[model samples]
Target: MQNSFEYGSTRVKPQRFGDWVIEEITVSEDEAKFFNMRQAFQGKHSEMITAGKFLRLMQVSTGYTVMSNTPMELKSNEIAFKNARGSVLIAGLGMGMILEAMLTKSEVTHIRIIEADMAIIQYVGNFFKDDPRVEIIHGDIHEYEPASDEQYDYIWIDIWDDIDVRNIEQMAELNERFSNHCINMNLWSMDLLGCEPEDYYKIAM
Candidate 1:
């Protein structure tokens, strides 16, 4: 790990993984690099996991929802809390920071996390095994099926692996699933104040 900088409401810092940083929470860098660093960490799976264990240990569950970091306060402070008691769906379940925050709120009833990696899920869930509100789903988001009677208030999508965006129909279906959803669909790369690519960091709320 290295010294950190401020990015929106969170602080960003370089970790062990290639050109990766953490904002608001510390991300895990303990495992072997499983995929391309350029696409996964900064691009899609930004919310799946974080570096710090304390943050994960403190979270109510191992589920999370994250979007753009530039407008951090906008998304964080303006979450839809009305008529939300049944369940909330999250695309990525990183270090469990966002879900941890959701649990702090009085309205959120449960969380269903959809993650492609089971190993990552196990790492986080091993700590919060006692929490009943968190449910981990080990599968791809494209294969997910929503119940006919189910409608979620919030759906956050942040993918770490490369996706086939040529399928517009699939994207549309994802859009229709959540009443409220946020996606960080762009890569935020920067090298500021003598910082390397690893030192660059931004949150894409």
Candidate 2:
């Protein structure tokens, strides 16, 4: 690790691999970041707030914010980590942190992670090169499909950047595609946040 590895809610320094960069490190709480955290981590996570510093992984090409290891994000992925077992199909390859967490579960026999970005698999894939259980494939989640007999025990989708009602539609679309392959399919925060399309609309109004 270049500086410090942050996963499941912790932060330190920024690291980079190819076009992918992880940053937003600070020794003290930045006021703007603090406010953003307060807005996002309100209600239950309000008290757990410590500092505003967090790791941000993003792609410089399209200015697409990849993912973070914030507490909210870590909390969101807990459901998938708990229920993951057997053959698993995961969408997205952010910072390779989730894969690090998934590798801890002995019940998880194999994981086939499908990422749309090729730059990620080229660089981030090096992190998991030693792990035979993980197979990172290059494909778009929307267009990718399994073989005729291909099936999985669990399917986890965290393809979106943040928690939004728009993600629900994406999840539904993915569900329609991969539902038959697994006993359970979990979308990153679709269940963890416990919000729906209606909730987001109400918030907007």
Candidate 3:
């Protein structure tokens, strides 16, 4: 953990796993170093690395979502879930911070979390074992099939391996399929800084 920097609306911190310092900014096109770093940190599963108030989800593989439970990130999702009630479906479970924030709202009755990684589910599940409102389902959001009778009042999709245009478009497509039309549907957007797609590539390069 290191001092934090302001990245768009969120406070970004550098996460050190061995020799690799995982910064908030997008890495260069050459991902070999990051891949190797992932290998080094792979065996350390569900180890919640903290810097200030943020929680870092370190994984063993590359090309997966890189998330930090920053206050700005948590606040945005919390505000979105303010009026949320009945049933809410969350597509990605990072560190369970968002889920915890949602629980603070009395309107929210049930929360179903879909996570692709069982390790993450196991790790995060420990924090909410006593809560009856939370349900963890191990499955990819793309392959997840809700019960025929189930309907969510809010659908939030935050799965992002990278914040590129293609990934953003994929999230949009998934939201269209799974989101309840009558209520609110939210997808994590990388356009937080109002930068164009080309600008992101420029920064990464």
Candidate 4:
């Protein structure tokens, strides 16, 4: 990953929403052995990571669904992380991973985050509550719309539980709402589909 953050910066009690809980998770060495290298960043890496381990920050839902700061998640968001600049708006605050990553870039002047789950904002969002340049909102990405005069340099949509070809429809609806609100916007996993973030516009069209 291109940016690193100190997980210890924030001290808060564990928070949960339904079956999802915002907390740290330790992955065993045996679990790391089966990692798909294609999904993780290979160089420099991020902070708090060891050779056989991943970052501890994570949000776990029922059935062991995880949203974490693991290398795999970093790799998936890397392109957007590098391309993001100026005022950025990110949907889905998963363990505040991408939100914290954006803090490392001086070029990013402001960050606005929207997450559907209030528990996530109460939990993961607490870490950034003191940052003047960041705003955390509780809202649904599918129904939320930006203010009329507000615009962002970049926008990232990452609300899905997982990447699926069926996500294209929702992405298109997002494009319709945000196309003019941002100079460039992206949906996560477009790169995994063998398309650049910019290509997302074309792919959806």
Candidate 5:
């Protein structure tokens, strides 16, 4: 059964944090499990919209439906995104759930996405192509050269399944570049962020 909201002044403040709000939130843990199951097996738009097992970060309201792809990068303790202005560069587009959130923040003006996997980039661009705020770059973030005079407010690195740690030297180089540019760098570690049986959940909770 669908849930309905009893109208109230403050309650109708348009539940929004960033670019999203509590569209609907399923209360029952069992319902959440069932919803997750449906997403895992089901295809169509649900698969694209769903954020896998990372939906826990959303502060689901008493009666609102929330769809997310994994816990949001900003909400995760291991992964962090800071508020800033001007252009931002993001590595590893993933399903673009984070990118969508980024667009909602008025502080962010332009977005340059770096993705190594063509297929994933293609998928996200195809789905979100209509958004004029995003600029897609299909190449290795390590190889791409930020404009000589370009200074970004933020640089987010989440290459590979999570943060690509195999290339420590490359990571160091990127960090150095970010430091030089006075840009805040964020590295999203899949080892820590990926859906695995780990005790970090306790800390996160």
Candidate 6:
């Protein structure tokens, strides 16, 4: 789908860091107004409403959702990418933002992306189709089993719809089972805030 945010008349070249490229676009005031109006009608409040600037990663297929301009989301990306290394496994591929960031890290060797939705895979696949370091697996995380010979150095999970105790438990369980021998395992819901597993469950209950 075409992005609802209008890219103003500015020739901004995409910036490349390692294997990842990011394009900066000017978000027109008119588009922002329309987006706010649509959100109001839908009774939704989004921090992603473009005001002046927006970033577009070439690796993502879903144009609108792929835009990353929010401060909180950007900070989360920073934390996640900083900890990524070696043969990595990511559970969710939302807009491929985390994937793009991880690709920029020289420490990351091979990345295995497991996405349950075929449409998301098809959309984001266009960006990384030529990259030999990436392997896209179409499967559900809950039922996923790594080959006996396969082992990852990092397992990052971000499939939760939102942060809650149940989601934390499920993600922790996945990590325990799939990445027991991995060097590191992280969850987007937990790692970003530096929240301990015990603390999270305690507060959640």
Top-scoring candidate (TM-score): 2
Error of 2 at 179 (Å): 1.0
* Candidate 1 wrongly placed segments (more than 4 Å): 1-86, 160-171, 177-205
* TM-score against native, each model: 0.45, 0.77, 0.61, 0.75, 0.54, 0.63
User: How high a TM-score does candidate 3 get?
Assistant: 0.61
Candidate number achieving the greatest lDDT relative to the actual structure = 2
Record all residue pairs in model 3 with backbone atoms less than 3 Å apart, i.e. clashing.
none
Error of 3 at 182 (Å): 5.4
Model 1 root mean square deviation, Cα atoms: 13.2
- Kindly indicate the candidate among 3 and 5 with the higher TM-score: 3
After superposition of all CA atoms, the RMSD between model 2 and the true structure is 6.8
Sorting all predicted structures by lDDT, with the top scorer first, yields 2, 4, 6, 3, 5, 1
Query: Between 1 and 4, whose lDDT is larger?
Result: 4
Candidate 1 achieves a global lDDT of 0.43
From the highest TM-score down, the ranking of the candidates is 2, 4, 6, 3, 5, 1
- Residue 99 lDDT, candidate 1, scale 0-100: 53
Residue pairs clashing in model 2 are none
Which run of 10 residues does model 2 get worst, by summed lDDT? 196-205
Better by TM-score, candidate 6 or 5: 6
Q: Tens-digit lDDT track for model 5 on 81-188?
A: 344347877876654656665665677788888877675555445666777878898898778777678777776776533233464545556665654453555555
Worst 10 residues of 6 by lDDT: 1-10
Candidate 5: give the clashing pairs: 24-64, 24-65, 25-64, 25-65, 51-68, 51-69, 51-70, 54-70, 54-71
Encode model 6's per-residue lDDT on 44-118: one tens digit a residue.
443336567655644443332333544435654555577778899888875677777777677889999998877
Tens-digit per-residue lDDT, 28-140, candidate 3: 43453454456458642222232343345566455343666554455445544564567788888766667766776677889888888776666666678788999988899
Model 6: residues with Cα > 4 Å off, grouped in runs: 1-52, 55-69, 191-205
User: lDDT per model, in order?
Assistant: 0.43, 0.71, 0.58, 0.68, 0.51, 0.64
Off by over 4 Å in 4: 1-18, 23-30, 35-51, 55-61, 194-199, 202-205
Single out the weakest 10-residue window by summed lDDT for candidate 4.
43-52
